[model samples]
Target chain A: MFLIIVEKSNEVIYIKITKIAKAGTLESNDILIMVMPNDSGNIELELESIVMQQFGDVIEQVILHKVKEMGIEGITIKAQDKGALDYTIGARVETAIKRAI
Target chain B: MQKLRRTMLFMPGNNPGMLQDAAILGADAIILDLEDAVSLTEKDSARILVRDAIKYIDYSQVEVVVRVNPLDTEFGPQDVDVIARVKPDTLLVPKADVEEIKLVDIMLAKIEEEEGYLVGSIKIIALIETALGLETVYEVIKASQRMVGVLLGGEDLTADLGITRTKEGEEIFYARNKVATVCRALRVDAIDTPFTDTNDYEGLTKDTARAKSLGLTGKSAINPRQIEIIHAVFAPTEVELKQALRVLAAMEEAEKEGKGVFSLDGKMIDAPVINRARTTVELGQRLGLIER
Candidate 1:
């Protein structure tokens, strides 16, 4: 089971990724992700929605979105994961975006 | 004096993916390993791979260190000879017993003399990974003037001690605390072992904080993702920076007034506090937190 919790504000976005697997260690079986737009838009929510819709099919998606109704310039995400997360897989595309920003 | 080195990231000698990710990880140093990470059958190939990576990679900001195979290994001396020739920032000697330290010192001295290189130009970091090694940390740290740091290799230490490497680092606490204290007494850098569970941020953060509290100058990173956490733990926060600056200013003011002692924020300030302030400034400079 995997869980994604997103808390958004005018200044930052707090994300917590929780996952559990048959494997004892998270070294190779799990993925955690968070994303934000570089140029500032409703991109974080959009990105979160897109990721959830895509990987939601393969992995569990317990996503919680907390979008601020005011000025938001940057995004900050924290992913607390339980399994091995890859950089290229669907679960990590948004994470790559976060790293890029 | 050099500023503290906070994050030392490890890259397996033969893993190109890890090597490629290292320089951009924002770690203070990158330790390319040719030891335990490589199999006996792949040792020679790993050495070549490490050498090539060193020669080609920019490593513009990160200090580069190569963990050569242990002295007893057939490939160990050869690994050192080749790496010393290339001249990375430092050489990390594994299983650094007293004998091994003496051996590496002699070999490095010989190489420096034969090649007309500056004697002791390359820094040495002795990794204490075995029970025997832990028993002789002081002698090992003192064996060579080229020694810049001492690293605790907990995984191997635990294996040697026949214990499970736990998350709390209890099994290796004695060794870890000993190495760190020894380094502090010797006035050299001490590095903590990596937390192998790379994905566990809570675990990693908690461990890094513990390592920092033990007066460790740095902690090794098993993955690029661990760099930020390590850096944040070691980096001077705004409060620390402000206090440091105040203490420094008080000292300068006292000197100007011809007084030997100064009071800062209603507390007497002395050499140790001043030294800490100066170190904070140096760290900020080295880390680019402020304009030099």
Candidate 2:
């Protein structure tokens, strides 16, 4: 799945995800997200999960919502889902962003 | 009311998985760590996470404590700033002395004023981790009206004393003894530092026994597995519970008979004995070892 959202940002993006940071666990009903900096100034998402064939779009929407909520750009989010809820995904994204900053 | 604090488990503030389940882990208190548990680079984000956790988390039966950085650090003011807005059950001031505690007290007062919370609603737990802090612990305990307890910081004290840290904990003996004594003198709870060896359950048990013998009300736990042992070690024993019940019954009878003193099994039971019994019963009730 792919997503593209346009928002005005004139400030220079100097701070990036300096390291490979991760959140959540590989446990049942959990999702592990690996977030890193992207050079293309676009939010790139790569998802892998058994449920992706069914709930791929919904999961992408959740990740996109959190990325936009944090005002985060130029980031790559790789989410490995195992039936995690929206709250869990949002929390993981927030933690990854905090670690990146 | 002074709630039970037999086991205060430390959950890393930045770890949402831990924070989300902290209250349900059967600890009497949960300390969200924004200090040593979190790295320097992630301090700001950790504080923000902890602030949101306190606001949103349903910590109904558990007391929530935030261990903020020392006031001397750049993060101290920001930690307090977040705390003022969230208003946790208590603030665990790390590496604290009289001056530092007073500073926190003053800032809490100002924040309470600005935030429109009740003045002195947020309690303070002074963590004595330095030579100076241990030396002046008496003043530190009395520095603020909101003071609830004092905790010994074993690792920091060992580092400050230039001694090797050990599971045996001989190096922190004097500091632990002094903190317990001062806390007793001030009628405050004395909380011991965590036993760092999470893998060694035997060592943790022995350490907790030592802390109980020293008259410390509680000990901090770095892991959830340690909580049950801490609570078990601190629970009122069966014999003590029976004695407390008898003493309370006798006291009530004496009061009804207009008597100030009484004899139980040929031993005198007076104000001090009754007070001790009351404490035992209260502790038992709080631990759920006895009927309320």
Candidate 3:
């Protein structure tokens, strides 16, 4: 039960080094996402996952859905998965998109 | 409906595995930390992840508490703005500054208005860690209508006092007792600080026992391993439960016999004893240790 006493973090200095951005982690039940600019004009997704056999398509769907929800295109995405849940996948993808844009 | 909060487990805000596994760990509450646990660079990611976790994950088995960073820091506003909309059971405000807490209450009201969450539905817990905070413990407890509890931060309090914290907790006795007593006096929950040495179960037991002896109702836990021990310390023991059952039964019989007090185990069962026995019996029933 907390109220927002707003203090803006001055530490967030956004210096975009390049078009590539990353978020999430390689830990168990997590996914590492990398977003980079691509001239292909379509989302190119590369994925590796521990539970690929059981839920690869589902995990990939979650990633694509989040990427679409953020209204992003013309990027190549690489997600290294360690069996992350749908929420984790969505969060990581959203974070990477924010960082990239 | 006595909420037994013997253990409140703190999971890092950024970790997916821990958050996924947290509810099944048997803690009465899980605190997802966006404070000291997350590094500066990862704050945004952690906050976003935590928001998604609360939104999608079902943490209804236990109370969900989000420990936002100190409101004086920049990350705190977003922590409260985003997480409060998701409706966590409580938000633990670090530092416990009375004025800041008041400001936070104002902001939470605005968020609740925008999100259509009922005003004062979410709760606040004050983290008593500094001498100045301890001084304003009463004010902090009264800062908001949503205030539910206050937690002692032993490491921070010890550091503030310029004293070394011992496994025996010699340095934080006054702060612990003061917060515990004041919280009780204000009719709010008094939660003890986490035992930092996760490896030392025996020390944790002793430390928890000492806190319980001083009237702390529950303890903040650092590890899942500490939950059982803390619950053991706070839960009504079998002997106490049995005695409480007997006391209540006797009181029931005495009531039928038109007696105001009765003898149980050669001791007079009076109002206070009956109240204690009722609490114990209710707790045992809640834990399924006794038939309702």
Candidate 4:
């Protein structure tokens, strides 16, 4: 099972699912947390941190692409996702990305 | 599997001028890069531009290849949809894995099967730039019979390996050689990495030559100037042509004499030698060294 919490100011989002899981954690000053887990079997992934905060889009794109590129089949990402602190989101995403891969 | 454009010049998918100029650049092929070159904000725009370019532009001699973001990215599946709809000469996917390869193949297959395009009509060129990709090269290569070649993408490879860049090529030689060896064994073309230094013509020449010597069928080009250099290095020299012809003539004589093997220019010629000669001829023609 995987548990995810997305908190944005007064808004909080949480998700929990069960399956084979690959997880990552990204947190920074801008975006608090984003976790991604893949439900696909026959694949193992580890999350790597992304240090740069300014380029969240680039980080996200890289991570997403790396996941698809690595073939993680099915994945569920839980984001304690925040905004503005892209560096944090990037780090969280990279870990999720690495895990998904 | 034919000699791909010596220069597969990359045009940023978001840049209209570059894409327009790319058609006129005389590059054998143009790869409208939707991956590294385009920023995340512009991926959608880039896709539109690429689709427009494919639909409107008359490429003539220039082959069109599109480098979609890796399958792991949000854009990969959509990118394939767009490219497959456009049906460019080839679809370039970066950081491909066996599953991704199968995914792209399945998509392309579904598209073609429904639309009646030949199964292998649209070529697939996988860029090997990750550790997992390197480890799975053999499986990945076999994932698609439509796979025409394997591309060595250096920048990403460096990132994947956590290594810094060096101009000497020493750092990448092993990977480069591995790509070539695998391609050769599978009888597929292996494309060498692009030379990032666009202004260094001499450097480009040397790099192209090195790639040729290392058994790469061709190298990628970030600019038009590098294409001719790659083509020149890939073209067979006059001496090679002479030797290839001698082998062919000797083989013909052997066939006439009902002998399976013979000596050509005091060198032993056998089935492998004859096959090699024929392959050279085919490759020479593809390279435009000989007029078909």
Measured by lDDT, the strongest candidate is 3
- Alpha carbon lDDT at B285, candidate 1: 75
Instruction: Give the local distance difference test score of model 4.
Output: 0.71
Cα lDDT of model 1 by residue, B176-219, tens digit: 78888999899899999998998899899989888878778899
User: Candidate 2 lDDT, tens digit per residue, B19-102?
Assistant: 789999999999999999999976866786678677777898899999999889999988998876889989999999989999
DockQ of each: 0.01, 0.17, 0.70, 0.02
Give the Å error, residue B242, model 3: 2.6
Candidate 3 Cα lDDT to native: 0.87
Quality of model 1 by C-alpha lDDT:
0.71
Best by TM-score: 3
CA lDDT, every model vs. true structure:
0.71, 0.85, 0.87, 0.71
Displacement of residue B198 (Cα, Å) in model 1 is: 0.6
How many clashes (backbone atoms < 3 Å, residues ≥3 apart in a chain or on different chains) does model 3 have?
Answer: 6
Model 1 chain B weakest 10-residue run by lDDT: B13-22
Candidate 2: which stretches are off by over 4 Å? Answer: A6-101, B253-259
Candidate 4: segments with Cα more than 4 A from true spot: A1-101, B1-3, B113-120
Report per-candidate TM-score of chain A alone: 0.22, 0.82, 0.81, 0.32
List, residue by residue over A1-101, the lDDT tens digit for candidate 1: 23333433455543332221111112233333443443333223222223444554333332222223222334433333333223212223332332333
Report lDDT (Cα) of residue B28, candidate 2.
91
